[model samples]
Target: MLARLATLCPAPILQRVDRLIEPLRATCSTKVKAGSVKQEFEKQDELKRSAMRAVAALLPIPEVGKSPIMANFTSQIRSNPELAGLFKRIKKDSASAPSTDSVELS
Candidate 1:
């Protein structure tokens, strides 16, 4: 639903939503314990990856009118190798997938 909301919202509202989603990374990291299992850590990483993908879709490819909030997020993705790989994978996946303005709720 958050992803859907991002799709429908205008730039200003999307900036607010971007702010809300940005902290997910920190929360995912701080919630983990020193003794936590590897699987638990992987789960949090996956959650962050999913959120990044959703936000990445909102930024322009050439970034002509990019919002500063989103541009900052984009720079973070670029600097992190693991996140960069995931971000690139989504862009490749999206290019091969069919484009549609409508959402499939299922």
Candidate 2:
């Protein structure tokens, strides 16, 4: 799971999670009992979830406010009215497209 998450998540997020789990990793050993191993696994899972929630909370939501990249892009688009209009048309078209929730059978 950690390997998969490492591949999927950004480096900064993974680094944060690694820091959060460093203590747990330090205590892990090959001599542990099966029950203790299970307990440790549960603890690690909990820590991972907490780290994810923390990262998620830190991220800027579009509905709340624009992130730096989004803000810059918005500014650029506003500076070019034609580009802004083109984006608006594209957005409208995408919004009006039919939903693909229902799959058509061959």
Number of the top candidate by lDDT? 1
Which RMSD does model 2 reach against the true structure?
18.8
Per candidate, the number of residue pairs that clash is 0, 0
The lDDT for every candidate, in the order shown, is 0.56, 0.38
Cα-lDDT of candidate 1: 0.56
Per-residue alpha-carbon lDDT of model 2 for 1-106, expressed as tens digits? 3333433553554335435333432332113456677877677545544433332232222221223433343445446564445444444443454322121111
TM-score of each: 0.62, 0.30
**Which sections of candidate 1 miss by over 4 Å?**
25-34, 60-65, 98-106
lDDT of 1 by residue, 57-103 (tens): 45432331255655555566677776777766666677665442232
Superposed model 2: Cα runs more than 4 Å off: 1-66, 98-106
- Model 1: colliding residue pairs: none
TM-score of 2: 0.30
